[model samples]
Target: MSADRPELDRCSRCGECRAVCPVFRETRRETDVARGRLLRYRLARDAGRFSAADREAFSRCLLCGRCLEACKAQVDVPALMQIAKTDSGFAAGWPSLLTEKTLADDGRLDAAVRRYRSLSRWLGRATPDDSGLRLRFALPYLDAGRLYPKPPARGYLEQHTGRRASGVQKLAFFAGCGAGRLLTGVGEAVDRVLAELNLTAAIPEQACCGLAAWGIGATDAARRTAIAWVRSFAGEEYDAILSPCASCTAHLQTRLPQILAGTEFAADAARLAAKVEDFFAWLSRQDLCFDLAGLKVGAHVPCHARREVRDGAAFVSFLKKSGAELVKIDERLDAQCCGMGGSFGVLHPELSRRIGLPKVAALRAAGAAVLVTNCTGCLWQLRDLAARFDPALPVRHPVELLDR
Candidate 1:
């Protein structure tokens, strides 16, 4: 495989991925799909043949890993996309801005969350008839819409400490940026489940899992962020590291070990991989049970979970065991991308929505009252989509279901 174009060279151009690639199905443009992108990247690498505009197109992909799942040739689309991003010098666009604003400094994130907390409380005090609440009634942007269950009060990591549990097993919580900042409820639910297992969790002040940075060709940023996280967690030792963020879990389980290999943190990375368990996987192995009486649920496994861990199916088993009626969304569960590929939804909203429609349809067809997924990005997009389609179709992180 070519160093600069490993994925491009590895992709066999089998065209097998076309049927399952959401972007391909939408635009029907070859270059918009993984294979064509790989071919172009390969050509660019070998022949010095890419225009600046073409390089920008390469960064447009969601890096969802759906094509990798469909490929009989076993191509690593996300890895290859990372290589492309690194070689192309493209930033993750809106996510880059968001990252710089939120992740560039943890102090800012904390301060921002404090402000959000204040706003949330102030908004809660107002009735629909109040001046503050009524001011946004006529404005489209201000009425951006409210989420169901109103988001959680505190992130899971905020509620726990490393010494919370004294028991047979312990875990360190890796609440990826999305979970810590955006999906606090999911993080809290994870904490509840961890408590049920009698395992204390170390809520470390870690950086983003570096998945977003890697996806957008921010290689140095990704590495620096990852190294910082590793350094922050340098002295801590736990039986395992766990996260409810499926994409974060996948990247940590698969990519981080490779990135940190032969470095001072290599052993820590390997240890984390060994200890890292998807929430459902751990739940399945435990004897704990949830009071999911009369609950009807459906699951959408993220492409990263499907391609990297392939154990998201354990969620189905776990749900079934908890007495929830598990509605199967896709028979193969290998449906096309959810369209909210990490930062893809922000970068190309129209394309993301176009690709997301099918996934939304699949969940609607399942007819379950609630949809559950383990990925933060999937939860965000699917939740937004559910509100757009029918505010009644509630979307949740699986940990939320387990918590309930």
Candidate 2:
């Protein structure tokens, strides 16, 4: 209920968030820090003053949850930030609103893909690399090379035409927007893994999970996207709905039901959210044997997934069962953000790269040849970092390595 009944009043500005906030650590700017942002919002909200600068400060955050975890006061920082991005604000900003509009309007999005690709090429940033290209812009902060990822020729859901998959355990695979659109191979890997376990998960048409909207503080857009997703699968039944993407898993399971509250779709949201579970937890529970073959892999836990799924214990258990030597970065266990906080990268690209690249550098420095995690968002980030920082190293989804 933090989104509706926000608890900015809880923050005493104790500054404990300074120690763990990924954005604060990177920027060290008072505006980028959680305490500072909360203080900024509190003063603005109390005075009935809102500005473009407040919107920038809010969008600058990674929404990684490290602040809330470290805060003694347990402030709902992102929730308070969302108040600025909601369209209810007197025209907060057009670009943020326009981006959310594009996300919510499916026809507009499908049409824009080609336009975006064309724009990228015209801007001299086009990359057609199939092996998880990390779009490094010509910005001074990024390593100077063009690596924009191309969408799959067809999406995963587009390829899988059947609704009734062959398995005793029926699952609805909610391929989050990235996997459904940009990283379609992740969906294929999930399919292969499911079939290897003698199970088939139906790939239903899904909208973007709306965390994108939430990250940028577009509350209404996030709500509309959530409702559309809930309505898309209204009549479908499944043992559980799974998305290999950790961000999607976390949002649908933890925050979505609350977002849908007081609406006709509230019950449906609650029902769908209840059926969602972490992909790794589900796999580890299946007790499948993984042949590690003496390979040691590095791991990074995404901020959103770390907060919502709590799968570190489960992932460790799965790794133990797999018999692989795990090289986990201690910072990830401390719940560090990967810095690809979705649109946070867009709002503050240099800061985003600064925060995320160090994590990847640490992994490679720690002698990891391959990095694995449950989040496609993290996968994209880690892969990009690998290409820029350690070209020979690779990043993968935990599911990608699970299948026989």
Candidate 3:
């Protein structure tokens, strides 16, 4: 945690973060903003332990990196928050333990999702479009009104593990939990788009990218998951490692190497990081023509894509190239978080909903025929939001629009 002291000290207390933090805007609580959290961290560092109030303050962040973007001193608030969570021992609790045991293991993760699928069938009511299910009653972590995606009969990895496509470049596909399991159609769209380019990607046997674990301050769990991910791609002859999940790609390209900086696999992680690419950024570089002309497409650039991958330019370029009429929403709402901060929504559902509603309302007002985003988490949140706010408007992955 001392390693992050310098970064935490860099905060100028400028209050510029107040202009961009979605959580702070909603709560207007000083404890929920970057400056207040940093001050608490400093006090806790001097005190040798975090107080109960300090721990609660640290848990309130979205870790969206918007504060970092606004800070002229370029303070790394997200990293500081993670370190604080670890220092406070809150990360070793049940949430992190669950992620470590289930998400880090592909078999257990799959089994857990299958169990949810079974439960959904028995107790959940199907939506009008049959795209997802709604519960008649709320569960422990699930809400009664939330729309959950219909689980595919088989996941993308289960169906395509041994499937191969031939192309000049050796490419590897990492279907993250969302695309691989919950939202299988996004994975299918990725395949269709690749086929249009006459390129085949090797689908690798992989687990979660550990972004969720890292966000929750489960550094050990995140580190173990990352190590397993690096090993999954090691000894493979691939020119690039591609993922449809922007959050996963960003974590792999930027954070994974740092997580394993002093480990034995550091070199391998660095090499893989260099090769990791977001599906949209990679496809944007290709000479493929898409017939999205006249389609009114609303875009939700995930926070990770904008802050970590720095792919906003590529995302905009891709949409413009497709001849899709990009619908313009409110300036305040544009590029704001969709409030699916991985586990943030699960932990703080009401705050997450409040932060997300404005963006959904803006899109609906803009008359967007459909909403498109590349991140699986954003897809789930946006889809649920659209279903509740505007059922006629569909949510889709960018690749799906291109493949069409």
Q: Against the true structure, candidate 3 has what lDDT? A: 0.80
Candidate with maximal lDDT: 3
- Report lDDT (Cα) of residue 174, candidate 3: 91
- Per-residue lDDT of model 3, residues 1-404, tens digit only: 45356676788888999988989999898888999989998989878977777777877888888887778998888878878887886665544335566667788778877887898787788775424777788776677777777787788887887555479778889999889877677778888888877788887677788887877777788888998898888878688878888888888888999999989999999999999888877877788877778988888888888888846336666887878888898776886888878667766777888888788788778878888888888888887888778888888888777766
Question: Which tens-of-lDDT digit does each residue in 1-404 have in candidate 2?
Answer: 12333476677778888888887776789888888887777777667677877777777877777788788878877666766555225224435533456666555555665565555444444333544444445543233442445666665655663466568797888887677766666788878778778998876555677777766666777788888778766678778887787888888887889888889999989998888877777776784676876767777877766677646336655765788677656654336777777766655656767787877777777777678877777777666667778777867777766653
Q: Predict model 1's lDDT versus the native.
A: 0.68
TM-score of each: 0.84, 0.88, 0.94
Candidate 1: residue 312 Cα off by (Å): 3.3
Candidate 1 residue pairs in backbone clash: 85-217
| Model 3 / residue 283 / CA error / Å | 1.1
Candidate 2: where are CA atoms >4 Å away?
Answer: 1-6, 87-108, 117-146, 310-313, 332-334
lDDT, residue 367, model 2: 72
Q: How many angstroms is residue 150 displaced in model 1 relative to the true structure, after the best TM-score fit?
A: 8.1
- Per-residue CA lDDT of candidate 1, range 102-169, in tens? 44345565666666566665444332210112122322112224221233466444554333435697
**Worst ten-residue run, lDDT, model 2?**
139-148
